[model samples]
Target: MSVAIPIFKPVSQMQLTPGSTVTIPDVTWEEFESILQELGEKRASRIAYNQGNLEIMVPLPEHEISKDLISDIVKILLKAKGIKYQPFGSTTFKKQGTAGVEADACFYIQNYQQMIGKRRLQPDDPPPDLAIETDVTSKTTLGAYEAIGVPELWIFDSGKLAIYLLKDGKYIKSEQSPYFEDIAITQIIPDTVERSWQVGSFQALEEFANLYLSIIE
Candidate 1:
């Protein structure tokens, strides 16, 4: 039985009101997945649907202090370092109840290009090199990856961060991942930057930006 939890929605501004007569669109799981083909970029919007009859209501991340903060921070540093990555998961969780979590940020190392062949990536492909999550600590998102057997995962609370790596089909707490050593617990979240805004804050990012320019010189 699917239950409708009264959780806050991302596009709450268009709340359904009594006698308002709103048009709620409906689509099948296959159609929903087709969206990614057209959008060309992973969406941060959470969606609804069912899998084997289990109902779900995954929505785009709201004003999550941690997700916003960490995402921007990682993006700035990665860009400066000439690293290529994409933010996947809950920000783009699957709508059909598959581990449709879009992490605040997802990193794919140079080796990731190997997964690309004549066509798109295959199902057996490994997960992103690094997965950065925010807000709730529950395993809903993590569980999804576990089902697909992702190798590494990271989650950030308001001020704290956790990194997990897959081992023998299960995850264990560790300080590092073979993919990216810099994202290890020791360096991922230092005291200097905690809030989502601070990750890409003008002052902090500018400092790194200047350093990047200097390196190029």
Candidate 2:
């Protein structure tokens, strides 16, 4: 009788965890869907899938704080301006035979009426008019979202806001928002965020409401 021993080698695949992003290249669409299925709900919240590439991110405290603040401010501004909107926070946008992305926060401004009272979304549902992403640990790319055809993207990075407009199947850095065409976000949002850090969201939101109201008035 003879005994045989097998040698093991270290695997190189990335292991994702909180407060970081893991990117896996050359992934198949089926494999991506299986990963999403395995993640179920909670874990899948932080996943983004591109063409043959998967990126998983864990939001830090700062990331969450900034995301919520940014979302709250946007809502406040919308209300102040008397604009109709529907908040679709982090709703997973998955396209058939294409990429999928979970934005930090999303909103239906121009298309709000279209998604009224909807519970579940289909693959063919119109994408959100605006999606806000907080970039603290990892940069959010426009490629995956381009496939989804999200019209406007707001990236809050390093205490600054950058707006991108989707035009002709690509993203272009823009000075004004497509939805809020007249408002100058770069002038207001940064200062409002800084104030929020100094004196809670409540006070900051109040101040932002007044600022927006003044502009529209």
Can you tell me which runs of candidate 2 are displaced by over 4 Å? 1-17, 136-140
* Cα lDDT of model 1 by residue, 1-217, tens digit: 9998887433334444322222223544554465445433543333222232112233333334445555666666666567766544343434333544445566666545764441444555556666776544454445665655556777655566667888887889887655445444445454424422455445554564454445533
Q: Which one is best on TM-score?
A: 2
- In order of listing, the candidates' clash counts read 13, 0
Best by lDDT: 2
Per-model TM values vs. the true structure:
0.55, 0.87
Tens-place lDDT per residue, model 2, 82-124, is 8899999988898776788889999998889989998989766
lDDT of each: 0.51, 0.79
Lowest-lDDT window of 10 residues in candidate 2? 8-17
